[model samples]
Target: MRARDVRAILFCAVTTLILLIGSYVLLQSALISLALAAGWLAWLLTRPRMQRVIRRLRGEPDWNGYFRND
Candidate 1:
């Protein structure tokens, strides 16, 4: 696999592990976990690259090609 792919996988795995640890630290409260997850989602949604990906997923065309057509 490509180095970029490997880095992405590692980032995801580490993020998940950190979230799990955060929940554990919060005494496994479902409400807290949900809030944390929602916060993360909100943060990601605000990112330019992520916005382009979301738009692409919804089949909306981006004029600037923020996300490469390739």
Candidate 2:
């Protein structure tokens, strides 16, 4: 893997840890924090731009009708 990919993964992991820790600290409940995180992730994944990215990753036809092999 490239250094860029490694950095991106680490960034995402740290951000997620911070979010979980912050959420727990503010909300005072593990379950609620987890739920909030799950909801947030769902919202992100369902966004149009993310959907396009996901489709591209899954080898689906893109917006311009270009087929990817994944």
Candidate 3:
């Protein structure tokens, strides 16, 4: 894989591992896990490049469906 792809994969793997460890240390509280997951998702969503990639992979017509095209 390309360096960028490898880096992205490493980042995602590390983040997932960290979240899993955090959840375990928190005694498997659903609320805490859900909150962490939601926050991570929100952070990803706010990144312009990630949103564009998601829309592209999902075959979305535009990044902002109700507004202007990306």
All candidates: CA RMSD (Å): 4.5, 5.2, 6.5
Give the Cα error of residue 2 in candidate 2, in Å.
13
Q: Per-residue error at 59 for model 2, in Å?
A: 1.2
- Candidate 1 at 69: error in angstroms? 3.9
- What would the TM-score be for candidate 1 when compared with the true structure? 0.59
Q: In candidate 1, how many Å is residue 47 off?
A: 0.6
Local accuracy of candidate 3 as per-residue lDDT tens digits, 1-70: 2354356556766786688678868767877776887787678656775555556556766635543433
The top-ranked prediction according to TM-score is 2
lDDT of 3: 0.64
Tens-digit lDDT track for model 2 on 1-70? 3354355446555766787899999989999888877876777667665566556557766557533344
Which candidate leads in lDDT? Answer: 2
Q: What is the full ranking by TM-score, best candidate first?
A: 2, 1, 3
- TM per candidate: 0.59, 0.61, 0.50
Between candidates 1 and 3, the TM-score winner: 1
By lDDT, is 1 or 2 better? 2
Error of 2 at 58 (Å): 0.7
Off by over 4 Å in 1: 1-22
lDDT of each: 0.63, 0.66, 0.64
1-70: candidate 1 lDDT, tens digit per residue: 3354355446545775688578868777867776776676667567675555556657877798543536
